[model samples]
Target: MSDNLQEDQQQAVLCDMCTEEDRKPARKTCMKCEISMCVHHLQAHVTTPVLLQTHPLTEPMASGAAGTTKCPQHGKLLEYYCLDDLTCVCVSCAIEDQHRLHNMKTFSTAHKELMEKLNAEQQALAKDENVSLEKWENGEREKLGSSSVRLIEAVSKLRDIALTSVQTSVSARMVSIKTSKSSMQVAQNEKDTFRFLQMFSQVHQDFEKAKAVDLRKGLEPGSDRDKLVQELRQGGEEMVAQAVQLWGSLLILVDPENHQEVFTTSSDLTFDPQSLGIGMSLSKDHRKVFYNSWLGQLSAHTLRIRSVHSTSNFQRWMVSLSEDCDWTIGLCDKESAENLKDGHVYGLRCQGNQLSSLTTDYYDFTDASRNLEDSSFGLQKVEIPKTEKKRRVSSQLIKCPGESGGDITPRPQKVEVFRNIAASSLSFFSRTGQHQRTEILTMKMSFDSSDFFAFVNLEKEQAQKSSNQPPGPQQQWMCSCGKVYIETGSGYSYGGCYYSKSPQAICSCGRVIGGRVIGDPCITEVVCELL
Candidate 1:
């Protein structure tokens, strides 16, 4: 604004062709010519036949360093860069045999374009890094906040207990001292020096008794400290659990809120209301299949079909279950539900951790010599191999995860079954309390749907919950080794106990429960995982 024009004019370069007496400021600089020219000389240079059709021109820099950088390839000032070869090329070298076919661009133009690209990528990287750092910091902050709250509560509780202990001790001591004082006063009032002198030892004994009360007993609870230690060490302890463990290792991420609120997520679960079995109702935005008291009920064995076949419309679907939840949970097609009274249908049934279903190969039911199991309606069981004791299986079926294909083991906890209907496969997996997915079973695609691919089976009604239900009058604890550990003549039966005389307990559900037999009431409770 203050006339830098005069300064520019004063520093203007003289035309190389102009005379000193009538010098003219340069208007253009030819990069090939490596010189400047005034307007008149520039026009003459452009018109001259000796010059090429066009000459490259650029503005002068304040430092006068423009057009001074040399190219390593041809040893001339670098005017262009060959992007194809990733090399610098001078004006003279650009037409040479080595770079004639190369894709060359002016250095300034190429540099400008590349700089913009680099800046954009750098900005994106910075944004990503900031987001990750913020998340990590937030997690640390939450942990610190929770820990501070717990510590403050624990300390305050201990402080109150210590204060109360000392206060009680002091009060008791004061009462003893008062009694001694009264006795001393009596002695003095009677004017007896001998009795008062002897009273000192008695008073000393009373003081010792006051000191005997423990200052650290209940006030310093060792259990509280032990709890903190145990929490810190919990991750390192060896844990025994039942689930579909991976072949080697896996990383599981969980959001407890996400799991608890699964019923509300409509996008993940697909339910067809029309295909529901009688007495079953949809809940939690149609993500859950639950019993409906208002609806007329059907037999528990009735199969619930999905309106849409997974093989055609949906490629995959998964059903999640909780521990102690009752559901057959499987993959079946249109034919699976039809003609089942004919003693067969194609489907995969997961009961507890075990995967059991009639396959292409089935039992020969005609064997009279061998013991045979009674077939249930719409279900055929290969006669269970006879153990030493032929214990009767419960009418209610419990399935477990991670059990062998033929095992009758019960899975009594949270698990999910994934069906890839088209691929003709079903996967059984389980989730621990920690919400980690362990794969339970992956069978070869056998339930190829002739029609239906997406199907589910559920009980008509949930068994009513009985509070504090004691062991039946005839409960007995049976071992996996087929011997009764605690025999009861009452003839009532519970799930077998978990532990045996052997080193390891082998069963599908991981543990067995026998209430009165092992003298453990805890056995009556279906345990999921140790929290």
Candidate 2:
């Protein structure tokens, strides 16, 4: 039984680095400095040049394994064995102060100790793995929970926009119909009055001709005829005056070359949370998270499409700002062989602070397989939206929770409301008229870092100042590479101030004039123009 157990143990000898069959005797020995060696380090000892210099002709150990041993410090061979203190020391270290204080030892003793310590560490590490696994699993669950919130909000907002659009269309149509009816009524009344006056006037003229003929003939007494004729003339004159008044009023019913113009200004969008940084929470519900990671470099100017299509099939637009002007527009699908062969790539270049890039097909999600390039890793999908309800013209002012007053008073300030002029399928306005149609798109953006997160609404406002005073500072401005524009007090030297409208702020570069009009100001800022 003892013999059988010894054979089983011998068969089970293993390498520290990996799981392999028991090492062969010849392969185990180090050629540079012969000594007892394990399979883990036998090859390394032989290949080391430093070990060969010290023990070029040493013999291998018998019974266990034949190999050379190397000094741990300098990788030198262990040629001269010491018997006093059991520790390995290189030739240089052997004469050092620390080693000189003790009686040095051979390589075998130190090597054995090192192997034993390594085995203990291995066992301890295995025990700790279970704890680490639990922690990792918990973290993953939290991430999933956060992303769910953002996705829900995004989806809900889309639905609300659709419903609002339908309601606005119906309201506009009703207004148009009412105006048309009013115009028709005024025109019809004027025509009726004019016809009546013309008929009466013709009768009076014939009567006058008859009176003249009778007077000339002197056939009858004139007083009765004159009285009758006078009364008839007076009635004709009254009818003619009425007709003139009615005809003048007809202008009100006419759809003249210039009509009453309706002007709508867009409302300013404000964000609830201010700034969200990387890996930050977007909301208190713990259902939203922000992630930002670097994707590979992409050549954004290559997309060329032979045919243009409607924007409905395109994906949502993503705006990233960095110091570099690399505005990227990703598509949901990659160009196939047919597309590539046909040169379906679109070229996008940076013009000042704006990016004028186009995409053959737009993409909402960042999917590399479906998209032409790898998608950003940190983008998350979430939905959390509040719906707006229509109220009467005499509606009470809106107030949030914890307000001291029952209801706040609406400010007498002029509000610029923007209308969707792009929806011309139903309405058209003359360009030269006083009132022109307008449309606006609002982008929901969240800025974040590891610990900070904020959500802000961004939209293009009409060029004219809505308030008596100039507008407040914009929330943020970014370049294509996700770089932010920083404003400085130094007149022209500052980055963003080069194009801002500050009398005190001038371009330090002296290359251009000062103010917003000096250079082409970024579209990120509100720009206004008359149609």
Candidate 3:
């Protein structure tokens, strides 16, 4: 009897619907109703569709524990989530209380939505992390490679200097030793006693001088060669330390979230006069570049701008090109510019009717046409054939490069270039019109050094007038009388409104239209009409 009473007392949860006289153990708890039920009462929750859907069932819970799931004021299960208040509320709280008219969703639906948003955020974060990691790895590799190259070059130069010094010292010592031995041999061959004695002192002095010569003097401490070695060692250590510090700084700057902040728009860029090739001339302000044929040479002339070094940070700039001219614009480091052939340069080139991303192993510095046969990278060559549609006269008037006459694709007037050092990307854009631009191409290449410069190669067929030049006499004109005239020169002749090189010119309507002094070579008065 005591064991039975103990067992009954050990059961912590009891059915709420059961009477105290015949209490039954709980099977499941309804969170919505905040009540524990035995199997007999729980059957309603399983069989009833509304209860199964609306009421969330859980393992048997104690009586007072369910109070937390209900709203404090309404004493109802908090089954709905209020989006506006970012809180959980019961149906009564959502519809009849302060949450009335607020955006709301079922608790399960809100949880699902939150989960989906979290998943998307996780995916975006992962992608950003991957990109940042790739950039960091590439930067490390490039930095290591360039540093190794510099170190190797420095060591090789030092080796050559040391070797040359040692060889020169050895040669001089050998010559002295040979001369001293020859003099001693001559002195030993003398038969006369007096001649032998006379030559003995000089031979002895020569022998002593040859013996005193130090073969390792050039390599000794405080010597020029020794100083060069010490300097190289100290410089190498300093360079390594500086490189490590710079790497740490770069790591801090390479955050994907702040990558855009690394880029800067520089508008005050100017042409580097020293980088201009023959036949290339810059305007007074070093902004505009003009290229004229030199002695009928068909080679291209290259001009470079003193823009930001590509390895330092991201940079962007814009350039305007002359219509109907062969041009190539790109970035090149100091080594590449000096040795254009067999050097890597990233650029976009427009040749004849074809536009392509410039990628060639061997580009002739003096001739852009030589690069046409080279393979292109990233963007495929797009041949822009002449359109048959009748276009504006301005576009048709301009001739293609190397073409005496004929139409071709309209040339892009402006180009915007972006150099992203961190991303190792070079992007090109063609400005189609005001506030509109189309991406030309994006090249992925490493900027190994800080000596990168913006380069442009232009080959113009002939000297052309500026696009801002005034209109000619062939422009249509309209008079105040609403009369339209074509091919009207400085003087007009229409409906007896004759204006010529006279002291005074008048229109048929008795209005003074134009005037010029008689026998004067220049017109004293000029009148312009709008059409």
Among the numbered candidates, top TM-score falls to: 3
Clashing residue pairs in all predictions, respectively, total 19, 52, 0
RMSD of each: 20.1, 34.1, 26.9
2 versus 3: better TM-score goes to:
3
TM-score for all models, in order of appearance: 0.33, 0.21, 0.34
All models: lDDT?
Answer: 0.49, 0.35, 0.64
Highest lDDT: give the candidate number: 3
Model 1 Cα lDDT, one tens digit per residue, 422-454: 566666555453444555556554433445434
Residue pairs clashing, model 3: none
lDDT of 3: 0.64
lDDT, candidate 2, residue 4? 94
Rank order by lDDT, top first? 3, 1, 2
Compare candidates 1 and 3 on TM-score and give the better one. 3
